[model samples]
Every structure is written in C-alpha cells, then in structure tokens.
Target: MNKRKIEVCLTPVLLPLYDIENSIVVVIDIFRATSSICYGIANGAEAIIPVAKVEDCLNYQQTDCLLAAERDGKVVEGFDFGNSPFAYTEDKVKGKTIVLTTTNGTYAISESRKTAYQVIVGSFLNLDAICNYLQKQDKDVLLLCAGWKNKFNLEDTLFAGAVVTQMGLDNFEYDDSAYAAEDLYLQAKDDLSGYTSKASHGKRMQKLNLEKDIAFCLNHNLTNVIPVLVGDKLVKM
Candidate 1:
C-alpha cells in the first residue's frame, strides 16, 4: 500500500503552494483561537461560526449567538469576549452558538474552507484526538498554521510539530517542512511553555498580561472534541 503524505504549511500565506483539494487540512492556531474552539466545543457549545472580519461577526449581534472578536491580542470593543479559552466555560457557552473573529485563525479557516477536502480546527488542547482521527482517515494531511497576521509564528509551528511527532513518520511520507517541525517539537517537548516563552506572539501575550491564557493554550489532551467545518460553522465531530 502507498503511504499517505503529510505536509506542513508554516503560514496561511503559503497555503496556495499545497494541494489541499485532496488533503485533510488541519487548521492550527495554538496561541488562542483554535484552542478556544476546542475548549468551547468540548464544554458543550453547539457550534462556532468563524468569520474573517469583525464586521462580519457584528452582523450576528441581533441573533442569539455569542459574539467574540479579538484583534492584536485584545478583545475588540463591544464584543462579549476574546479568543481566550477561559472565556469558554461550560456555564456560559453550553448549548450556545458563538460567532468568533480573530486576527489570524478565522481568516485562515475562511481562506481554506472553499478548497480543502476537509477543514478541521486543531490545537494542543486536542492533540491526541487529532492524531488518532488522522490515523484512521487514510487521507493525505496538511497541517495549516494560522500564523500571526499571515506571517510565521512560533507557537503554531510548535503545535504543528507536536502533531507531526504524535502522528509518527512510519506510515506517512513527509515534506521537508514536516521534518523540520518534528525536529523542533522533539527539542521542545519536555518544556513547551518554557520554550514558547521566547516566541513573538508569546511575548506579545505577555505584554498584554496573558501569561495564564498562554499556559492554558499549551496544555495537551484536554479535550476530545474535534471542531470540523460544516458549511459556515464549526461543529464538534
């Protein structure tokens, strides 16, 4: 049998170089967006609607959905919350639908939704579940990182590395980027928080006094909920 191929696109800007039509694209935004999505879905939120613009999220204001918008590491004025995972507690989001817009993550989802064979939210929070699901799917995989404002960021790359490491290399062919990510993961696996503290986004989060949020987003296997894009929204799969 031929081995399935796995490639890592370090940033959404480079996504056009990959053949996503036949590959399951795992959208990763480990700083906060995808992490929060996994947390919210696992906590019983019905669905998360990811929009590319803050204005797009505002259109849902009259509806029952919860509105969340984050830009430049801070909550956008007039939104219920930012992309912090702590804001997704079960007591607040259970049975509710959330509309979320972020600086990078949602934009990556919007860009890939039309082309990828499958688009699923990924983060360290659901690492094992994602790896196990990919093993059973038998499809080529694209680890799409939602870098900070279309530029490469360390946290997302590290999570991509973690996935590549967890997925193992025996049954799959990998690209140069995949090998590089795996190497990075192996080097930092023992102390992810300590290693990521040097990342640009991590430093930005620190400037914003979000050390706890950064810590929580880096935790592994916190949930089994995999958020798969279904039309315009992400529902637990």
Candidate 2:
C-alpha cells in the first residue's frame, strides 16, 4: 500500500488536526460563495483578497479597490456586489482587484492557508480542472468544507465527493462521514441542479430568491482556472 490518505473535514474544528504540511487543500463553499470567487478569477479578476470580517473588506476598500461580500445569502450593505456568479462579468471584474467576504466560505479559505502547502478553491463550476491539477500532484489531499454557520453543510461535502469520484483513485481512505458525502454526490451527480434545489444550503438560497445562482454554481467543469492563495490574495495558478 502506498499510504496515501484523503481526509474530508467539516470545518475549522477538524482543520487544525489535519497535517496539511506539503498537502493540497481543496476549499469548497458551494451555493454561490467560493464559486463566485473562482469565477471572478477565471473571468480575469486580478486577484481576490478574502477577509473573514465584513469590516476588513470595508477597510480594504478604502484603498480604492472593489468590495464584494455577503451574509445570510444577501449582499452586504455598501458592497459592490454580493457573492453571486452573475455579478462576475468581464466588464466588472476584468483586471480589477476584489476584496471579498462571505458568511462562512472566505473565512475557511483564510484559515486553511496557514496549514496548507497550496490552498485551492473548489466548486462545481471548476470540478474537472481542479481534479486534473490534483492528478498531477503527489501530496496528500485535504478537502475542507465551509459548512453552514459552523455546522456541516451538504453542498460543500457533495462537491468534495464529486472531486473524489472524478479523480478515480483507489488508494485512499474515506471516513464514514466522507463516505456518506461521496454517496450523496454519487446519487446527485446525475442531476446536480435538482440536487442543489433540495439540499439544505440550496433551500436557503432558494428562500432568498437566488435560485439561478445556485444552478450556475452547480454546473460542473465549466472552467480550468485554478485559484490559489498567493500571499494575501487569491490569484490564478
């Protein structure tokens, strides 16, 4: 056996336990959160500086940069945009600097950077491309999910499962929770749009009237740009 391990952790709680030294960290925050950040970079946004606090984004915006953020599935006050894919157009984001903050996603991204050798954002939008990158790297992998309000969210875990399945690796270990997530994704892969509409986080977005954004985020393999953390900003790798 090669002793390769694949660990899927729920949030900051399990984050510290994982030995991410020299490993690749796939941070997932489906439901139009991190997916929007990936799309922003893919569409030519210069870089994204993710902040855990809304105040931090506001402070950064003082430097004449664009600010985008969300909380409770709604756009934060005085922000240029919310965490939505439709907002990331070439006209708005191309060659621009984006300082973004979200309820749960960006915080996870910021925290994982400390332990991860390379932190990459993962979502349904860039599934195949991310998996392809992982295939070329030999390091251990940790799939970190930005769960809802400090609890496990289905969409992030499902996205992780999608990655595991797409990679098609046999030399890996899956905890019971990971197996459950993988199984959920396997069942939902055929109809991701339908799956998201029913997921807990998906329903939350639905109630907020952003159902279309959810659909866009669930569209798999739509991009090849891998957004990696470079210093304080996330740029295309």
Candidate 3:
C-alpha cells in the first residue's frame, strides 16, 4: 500500500506553496482560537462560524449566534468575549452558535477552505483524537499553522509537531517541514509549557495577564471532539 503524505505549512503566507488538492488540512492556532473552538464544541456548542474579518463577526450580532472577535490578542470592544478557552464553558456555549474572528486562526481557515479536500481544527486540546482521526482517513495531511499575523509562531508550530509525532512517523511519507516539526516536538515534548513560554505570542499573552488562558490552551487531550468545517461553520465530527 502507498503511504499517505504529510507536510506542515509554518504560516498562512506559505499556504499557497502547498498543493492541498487531495489533502486533509488541519488548522492549528494553539494560542487560543482553535483551542477555544474545541472546548466550545465539547461543551455542546451547536456550531462555530469562523469568519475572516472582525466586521464579518459583528454582522452576526443580529442573529442568535454569539459574537466573538479578537484582534492583537484582545477582545474587540463590542464582542461578547475574545478567544479565551474559559469563555467557552458549557453554560455559555451550549445549544448556541458562535461566530468567531481572530488575529490569525480565522484567516487561516478562510484560506484553506478554498481548496483543501477537507478542513479540520486541531490543537493540543484534542491532540490524540486528531492523530487517530487522520490515521483512519488514508489521505495526505497538511498541518497549517495559524501564525501570528501571517508570520510564523512557535506555539502553532509546536502543536503541529505534536500531531506529527503522535501520528508516528512510519505511517506516512512526510516532508522536511514535518521532520523539522517532529524534531521540535521531540525536543519540547517533555516540557511543552516551559518551552513554549518563550514564544513571541506567549510573551504577549503574559503581558496581557492571560497566563491562565495560556495554560489552558496548552493542556493535552482535554476533549475528544474534533471540529470539522462544514460549509462556513465548524461542527463536531
């Protein structure tokens, strides 16, 4: 049998270089956005509508969907909340739809939605579940990191690395980016939180006094829920 291929795109800006035609694209935004999505879904959110722009999220305010918009790591002035995982508790998200827009995560989803065979949200929160799901798909995989402002960020890359490592290297043919990500994962696997604390976004979160949110986002296997993009919204799969 032919081995499935796996590649990692370090930033949204580099997404165009990869051919996503037959690949399952997993969008990673470990700082908060994707993490919150997983938490919300696990908490029973009906669905999450991810829009590329804050203005798009605001447009949903007239509907029953909860509006969430984040820019520069802070909640937009008029939104209900930012991308913090704690804000996605069952009490708030249950049985309701959430419209989310963030600095990098939503943009990454918008770009990948145009061509990938399938798009799914991935993060440390659902690490093992995602790996198991990918192994069953028998398709090439693309780990697309929602880097800070279209530039590479360590947390997203580290989560990509974790997924590649968890999936086991022997199962698929992978590229240099995959190997590099695995190498990074191997080096930091023993101390994910400690190692990623040095990331640029990590420092920014610290400055914003969001250390609790950082800790929550980095925790592994918090839920088995995998958020798959169905049309414009993400629903549990």
lDDT of 3 by residue, 1-237 (tens): 788899999999999999998999999999999999999999999999999998898788779999999999999997899899999999999999999999999999999999999999998899999999999997899999999998988888888888888777688887898999989989998998899899999999999999999999988898999999999999999
As a TM-score, model 1 comes out at: 0.99
Q: How many clashing residue pairs appear in each of the predictions shown?
A: 0, 0, 0
Residue-wise lDDT of candidate 1 within 143-203, one digit each (tens)?
Answer: 9999999999888988888888878778888899899999998899999999999999999
TM-score per candidate, in order?
0.99, 0.95, 0.98
Report the C-alpha displacement of residue 106, candidate 3, in angstroms.
0.4
- The deviation in Å at residue 133 for candidate 2 is 0.6
Model 2 vs truth, CA RMSD: 1.4
Q: After superposition, how far is residue 91 of candidate 1 from its true place, in Å?
A: 0.7
For model 2 the TM-score comes to 0.95
Task: Write candidate 2's Cα lDDT for 1-237 as tens digits.
Answer: 674567788775678887898789999998777799889899999998999999898788558678988999999887888899998878889999999899898989989998688999998778889988887788777889999887888788888898777655575666566677788889987887776676788888888888889878877777899899989899999
Give the C-alpha lDDT of model 3.
0.93
Error of 3 at 122 (Å): 0.6
Rank by lDDT (best first): 1, 3, 2
